[model samples]
Target: MRPFNFEKVNSGAEASAAKSQNKQFVAGGTNLVDLMKKNITQPDILIDITKALSNTIEHQNKGVTIGAMASNTKVATDKKILRDFPLLAKAILAGASPQIRNMASSAGNLLQRTRCPYFYDVTMPCNKRKPNSGCSAIEGENRMSAVAGYNNQCVAVHPSDFCVGLSA
Candidate 1:
């Protein structure tokens, strides 16, 4: 793993300022840290957004305005979220394991990458992980690939059970 510089940001503006061509937004780092360790993601600087974003879950007239940094566990178990959106709660439960849910943020979960094998293998060519690279799985083993919403470029499925529940 590469030893990279870390910057503690206090606000979105600070985060934006700290960001660079080689910098990445480090929120939960549940996925980023692991990817970095694997050298799949090489960020020169990680702008920590955990402290910057408000983690409060507030009730609004329409619904609830969940903060960007609010953890999945909090969102899944929130009384208002569970009661008003049972499907969302169940979907969150069905998605990631308990430990991941505790640390992963709702915003991060919503921005998760596809669970495609090609995307995982650094050697294989994947368009989602690397834009314009021809998809190798277009004719390869694709029992898990998307069929309904797939395009000619990529057949990767957005793996988000909570997203599906939220949409429903």
Candidate 2:
């Protein structure tokens, strides 16, 4: 693990101003922190957005407004989100096992790294991990690779079955 600087800012303005060249907004570091520890992600500044401006599910106009920081479990279990936006609910349910969904957020889920085993191991050469690294999954264990919308470079399938169901 590498030694890095850490601090907490109170307001949105302060947080935005604190953004450095390598600074990243971290909300529910369920994924980012792990990558950092694994030496996959290295950031100079980590602005924790666990509690900042907006972090709640709201219904103001016609449709629903899903805050980036709202927990996936809450959205998956919320009557309103489930009833109105089953797509969102289904997506959440299909993601990150039950434990991860409980701690992950919608925005974070959208940005979660690929589940390709090759990608997980930093030592392995993966196009997604290192652009033009020459895809290994193409000729490797492709059963777990994509069943649709996959090309030669990367054949890894998206693990989110919920995303598929939610689209319908």
Q: Each model's C-alpha lDDT?
A: 0.83, 0.74
CA RMSD of each candidate after superposition:
1.8, 2.6
Q: Give the TM-score of candidate 2.
A: 0.82
Give per-residue CA lDDT, model 1, range 50-116, as digits (tens): 9988889998776788888999899889998888888888998888889988888877878876756
Candidate 2 per-residue lDDT, tens place, 1-168, comes to 577777677778888898888887787778888888888878887887667646688975567777777777887888987778788787678656878877777778666777576777787778887899877777777534787788778876665443554466
lDDT, residue 148, candidate 1: 71
TM-score for each of the candidates:
0.90, 0.82
The ten-residue window of minimal lDDT in model 2 covers: 157-166
Candidate maximizing lDDT: 1
Give the top-scoring candidate (TM-score). 1
